[model samples]
Target: MEMVLEFLGNIPWWGWILAVIVLVFLYDILQKKHTILHNFPVVGHFRYLLESIGPELRQYIVANNREELPFNRIERSWIYASAKNENNYEGFGTDRDIYEPNYIFVKNAMMPFKVENKHPNQKDPYFLACAKIMGEGRRRRPYRPASVINVSAMSFGSLSARAVESLNKGCQLSHAYHNTGEGGLSPYHKKGGDVVFHFGTGYFGVRDDDGNFSMEKMKKLVAENPQVRAIEVKLSQGAKPGKGGVLPGSKITAEIAEIRHVPIGKDVLSPPSHSAFKGVDGLVEFVENIAEATGLPVGIKAAIGKLEDWQALVTIMAETGKGPDFISIDGGEGGTGAAPPSFADHVALPWIYGFSAVYQLFKKHNLTERVVFVGSGKLGFPAKAVMAFAMGVDCINVAREAMLSIGCIQAQICHTNHCPSGVATQSKWKQRGINIEDKSIRTSFYFKNFRKELLEMTHAAGYEHPAQFTMDDVDMATGDKNMINTLADVYHYHKVAVPFTGIKDIMNCPHLGGGYEPKKEKKDVKKAIKNEEVRY
Candidate 1:
């Protein structure tokens, strides 16, 4: 009470006026951005603020029912259904996008049906596809994700403790895997849910008192967390490939210090490349060592780089016989916490391109049969996932879009530590706005809907199962009807060795999505918008 009185005493009559003026200024700035402008200054910010909460406010505050969220409406309902142990959804009319360019809408969709209809609308995708991680002749394991959609790498420090707890608990409730991003694994990470503890270049999960990788400590962590499903060597993320992660020291609170096992108030850097491995061959060898040492699937995450590097990598794999269980492709346009504006906007290939390129590369090396590909980049929609698979990707991962489904307003607050959605902020007040139970239910609901939509579309794509649909099954219709991009037109025999012969060698990953023109394939997907000169 004294502290409150003291705080109140500190503010003068002008302080309130100054605060209001500042708020008015911000409101004006935001109003222009949200496209909900009003002439009123102070009052405009209120509308801008509420507009900023566009989808979230509608889903959580206004829509008496929880299932009526943006994008992940069904997902929210599914979680509520599972929690109450009741039916996930009620009979409903269509809840989908009706008008949008470049959409995959059913030309003649069926009229709305009741939840009790003979065909109980599947709450989730009925069929799950499996990806075979290639090892030696018989060493392949099918990587059929229990759920088509899984959590992406949102680090613990980057998010709040309650946020992490909610995500872990949510994963447990939904029976899906959550990634322990580059930040060191928190105790909250071991909340009895499957985890993909990505061992970043800084060796976060293995750091010690000196803040470096400790083999013994790593072994201990692996032994303790039975739920740790896999170990990913995150080489480069899609948003900022060839860049290091920077967590300023000031933000490192006591709890964060304990979780990361690093001293508070010290900047942490996870470099672009790992200290453990040098080149691609060394990369493969180290992944193998980690898998052998940890007894779990070991894979690398990267954005599509130079074609030559990829070609060289496949050759190394063929000769060394060290094949990864999976390869997670991060697209150039992917989102991240706080990257330099340049890197965030102009770094790697878009997921669509990365998906195609990596898919093709894996096929050419015949590693596609052995190594599964998990695609990530602005992907949350069923059409997006199916398209990636049609282009050769095994699975897909979503980040910002997933956050959106779970009530993130994209206020760009992940780095500022002011997320109104508890999912990203450490602030107690902002955190309260994010009801863990409600958000978690919303999370599962979103994933279920995504799966169901994919199944429906994939089934329409002429495949009984999502996995059965091949590239030949997809067809692209553009204004230039003369240039048809069919399933066959998109993929060539994924030959392991590119003919670097008389033809200038080109690095092609099927994930690059066969460009509008084959000649345009050389442009990196990341450079799609800021194109300067053409170079693959």
Candidate 2:
């Protein structure tokens, strides 16, 4: 042993370093989870290390200011400036392509109406008004929403405890509401902020052992948490319309399991549709039931698809006069922690289109007075918020922007459960990077500046209140000989047409194959008419 120790002590420093590298290379080859590491040994770690920082590299170096997906550098810079309450002016003019299709511009008033020049009040604006839902139910009186842009549906399970705490604290300071996205109701949500308790297909906070909605549990929840200002029943989110919400088992803690009433270490799947309600009638009744139980305003959140289906729901409301107090319209461009590519990309209508269609429906049926609209999906800026208001959305919901305010670096690794920025993971070590107090202050500042800028635009448009903005205040840049057209001219009406009738009436359609058959009744239709009939 003394001879061996003497030999090791005699080794040079370079020799010791080489030996350590050789051992690590052997360990890498022995590992099975990563095929790259197995094939390349120690050299492969560089790929992963570089991949981990790939987003930052692209954001800062490779990608130009305007050439990024989901969000660009220009947009992110504005958010950062607002969060820090710093000057966000560009040195030169915009780098945006003004001649691009779908470009938007706000029409300023030549002679703007001047309201009292007052300090940015910082008071929570009474933005929305709710109608009475249930009769003689001992419910809390409906209070006006504090701000136009409030935190959107971000589940507690998708974010760490510290992240949720900071969000709640910031919301409390800003007099805004924090939405408890379909995960479950947790203690971290009750940090003195107004809460919007959302129920997805899982019914996480109010479900029984059999995974069914429980009225008794809901009643208990209402009795305990009076800070819950509203309830949002999520029909579908824009990012993944027909897919259920999936929380990987690795992110779930024992406390999360208890809160959600699920088994520990099991992936939690919220079904695509609600089990508590069946049809339109059933849905209206469910809304009434929750409103009655909690005495708080109730609403539904959905990504718009199947125009007929949405019209039918609103028509029933007009007929029965019993429905949700508000509707949250999610645009197809909305972000998510995780989603299937097909559903996220091609399923639902964009925010402006969905909002316009839904608004037209409400107006058509004369139900606009009863139902308020909350528009969501990438609405993080003042101009975008104004555009939504101009199109009849009562308020807006900000999710990604709020995360940015509290230090999400757009790493886009939220689903991996290894978010390096500490805003979207369960790892205690990662969360330690976040300072709650500092982030909370930044969140409040971001929200205040957002509201202030929106109001400024409202006043510049010669409108006293943002709600007064109409189609005349905004334009869609067409980039034609005539540069732009008012929103009213572009989206004047929701045209109704007979869909797929052409296919049914075509005489000997060129596209027809031998398998084609006339559309007929189920009783008369058969896959194969006789035993001799062949089918693919």
Candidate 2: 10-residue stretch with minimal lDDT: 127-136
Q: After TM-score superposition, what is the CA distance of residue 493 in candidate 1 from its true location, in Å?
A: 6.2
* Candidate 1 per-residue lDDT over residues 42-81, each given as its tens digit: 6555775777778666665666542442234454444434
Q: Name the regions of candidate 2 deviating beyond 4 angstroms.
A: 1-49, 118-140, 479-482, 494-536
lDDT (CA) per prediction: 0.62, 0.76
User: What would the TM-score be for candidate 2 when compared with the true structure?
Assistant: 0.83
lDDT score, candidate 1, position 302:
84
Each prediction's TM-score versus the true structure: 0.70, 0.83
lDDT of 2 by residue, 445-472 (tens): 8887887777778778876566677787
- Screening candidate 2 with a backbone cut-off below 3 angstroms (N, C-alpha, C), the clashing residue pairs are none
Could you tell me how far off, in angstroms, the CA of residue 357 lies in candidate 2 after the best superposition? 2.0
* Candidate 1 regions with alpha-carbon error over 4 angstroms: 1-144, 478-484, 490-536
Worst 10 residues of 1 by lDDT: 498-507
